[model samples]
Target: LQELPVFAALDLGTNNCRLLVAVPTRHGQFRVIDAFSRIVRLGEGLTASGRLGQAAMDRAVEALKICGDKLRARNIRKARLIATEACRTAANGVEFLDRVEREAGLKLEIIDRQTEARLAVSGCGSLVERDTQGVVLFDIGGGSSEIALIDLTGHRSPRLANHIVSWTSLPVGVVSLAERFGGRTVTREIFAAMVEDVAVRLHAFDGRDRLSHVLASPKFHLLGTSGTVTTLAGVHLDLERYDRRRVDGLWMDRDSVDRMVEKLVGWDFQQRVANPCIGADRADLVLAGCAILEAIRAVWPSERLRVADRGLREGILSELMADDGAWRSRGRQ
Candidate 1:
């Protein structure tokens, strides 16, 4: 295993920076050997300023430096680094990235929204069942949310995203939503406003009804990949601490999700921070994320929602390995 080729994937989202280093497996998949994640709040003031703040950029650069050091420590065979919504909309995004390369020795590409949506689907592919008729997969990010309506009514392809019937990336996310509506003290009315804002944007997507037939099928469900859903899953389990092993691929029925959201809505800021699953780092932003999730649920009512902790980074690794034909020798001695 030590001698196997290593691949790296890094995602610098609006709220966090994450890295994944893995080695291809005999079955065409990859096993993570090393990983890193940090909430740098790269888009902390993006909505009001329309530019990344100096303090935010510094935090992100520091995180990227750590990632750069990790990448250099290994015999990396390939790597793909990317920045999402924050960077795409930021006026000084390119400039800030320049500083990153000069200071951290890492170059990141700002991917388009469709690409973001597709990669999210790819990352969460394993969560979908083989017999599933359809899915409305959504990734809620710090700066924007990407939704993919996958119609798997026919024979499924190896890449789940290939079956995408319609996709949309809304210019709304936890950071922006929180900053706008005041996350720390969300009243029912404030929460409702946030939901309506996102719902307006989501409902406008002409493809919102694209998967009506699939939704009518018994196998159809919602697949969510983001910190929001993962947090809800952790709370629902009454976990003493965050555990990816337990939360990832977890299924929460509609009623369970409703109860969890209601539970959070009733708590004060400190109460939210007290919960192990919603620590101080995420307390303020959790409600905003919930608002986004609620809007999605309203548009696409599903009996169940599958939570995925994996997203862009895993998607990048999957695509890179496939492109390099790492799986061609599967099962070979």
Candidate 2:
């Protein structure tokens, strides 16, 4: 295991399948050696069907096969493969995973909402400024959205997730929301309806008052780790092509977010597909994401939001490296 230091984390979510392989670095971080992401729409029609359809299962299995091949090719010391909201909620989720194990030679563990929230916080830990008093971090996923209210009042823990005071996992996400509303032909009215629906769901969360209290302080800001926010950041920058270095950890003010959402709402399906950052694959779904973000913005109304392109996969790698004492052993060596 010591000789082969690579670790892998695979997150098979409702809409995407992603894999990351990394080696531990200084200060409890890791350097990415390889990564893969594919929008397979594994949860398509899942909302209406209640079970994973055969086609969706097939698409997911094909993606997993590629991931399995990569894992086998590497001399990996440890790895954690996880499935999120889709697998957690789908009636045929277990059976589908078993099929994945058989066809793709991968076993995917379905993680719960709380763990999802914590992983997101862990993934974006470095992005949060040390001086910041509090943060409202959110992950808008394909099948669900996880929001965490972090309070760093007394003392900061090595694990940023330790600072999370309250968290909520909304049942609605990009895929589900788009399915609820219409995605491809989104009008201003349709966009408003989407936001209102998510707002209704957000009303049930108990952390609203707590977050509202934290918002009064200037040090508190919103941080988002998801494709939805990342895509918005990309569109806002007017990048010729999507660049992670510039997009990740970038700051967008309330007005900027509002402006971007408005611009997107104005765009037709063809216009969205023409966008370099949001290509044909994401064209239909981006507005649904914006609506989710809008609901979040309405609740907290932060002046600035820090964008995060990192999430569950990064979190998994960090935890695996820490748990294995890879950094401690390296220091000794």
Candidate 3:
């Protein structure tokens, strides 16, 4: 607790390896000191091959090395690193993990699906309304989508009391979807097919009949935390530049989202690549995300969607601070 020790969080996923460093401030707030993200495409070819390619592994290791250096430079006192789906599904995941620990000097924990969804919820929990009835929270990553339905009245936490009523992880993600359907340029047919695929998987979640009852009520909110949602938000804002501060914590109605998706789909690959907020890096995969978002809209039919740029990393940091009593003390100050 002395001098507000800095905490570091590293998230290594199928598509990106990222690191974040932060110092908790008074009033239970924290300020980000540093962050690093590299799209390594670690899960490339995993869907068909059922393995993380050697080339992908090498890319991830290099990224982790850079993250290690950042953590060392900052001399982080408390740090936690985690690896997701691609690591857990790959045959050589353990081997790659060993290499990271020995070569990069970092131990990476492979968490289960439930933990992934829970952490995502924790990261965005601060945005949930305590009295807002049934709200759906989801994170669409490269390898999977984590969904959690919570009843607002169930919240017990000091800041928010939302309780998770039903949660599920869909196996579809941008990478997988792109690999399955197509990522480069999506046709209306391909787009509709992709959304249909996602809708089928969503059937496993808590009884839709029960969820619908809650959704029918007023102030029901849908919270989305992922590159997909954030990208859509950026497009909606029509920013010549992407600004997380402006996109995150913002609200977009169903009509706006639908219109934006239509505009994005109609744009040629070159036009999408030219957009400042999307750029070339995400141009190919944007359609895959649009498909997923459209599917969620069909299922839940919400009027508004809460966009969150925060997720796993924020969730992990919050959990660490809460366990260490740092978050609680910060509030008292």
Task: Point to the candidate with the largest lDDT.
Answer: 1
- Could you estimate the TM-score for every candidate? 0.98, 0.97, 0.95
Give the per-residue lDDT digits (tens) of candidate 2, residues 1-333: 446499999999999999999988787688898899999898899899988888888888998999999999998999999999999999989989999999999988999999999999889888888888889999999999999999986688878888998999999999999998879999888999999999999999987677555687889999999999999999999999999999999999889998999999999999999999999989989999999999998988889999999999999988888889888878833
lDDT of 3 by residue, 1-333 (tens): 368778888999888898889987764457899999999999999998998998999999999999988998976768889999899888988889999999998899999998898889888876876577778888898998888887765536653313777788888889889999978878889888999999888876664445666787767978999888999899899898999999989999889988899999898889889999888878888899888888877788888899999978888887777778886665666
Question: lDDT per prediction?
Answer: 0.94, 0.91, 0.84
Worst 10 residues of 1 by lDDT: 324-333
lDDT per residue as tens, model 1, 88-150: 999999999999999999999999999999899888778898999999999999999999999
> Which sections of candidate 2 miss by over 4 Å?
1-4
Candidate No. with top TM-score: 1
Residue 200 in candidate 2, Cα distance off native in Å: 0.9
Candidate 2, lDDT over the whole model: 0.91
Residue 246, candidate 2: C-alpha displacement in angstroms: 0.8
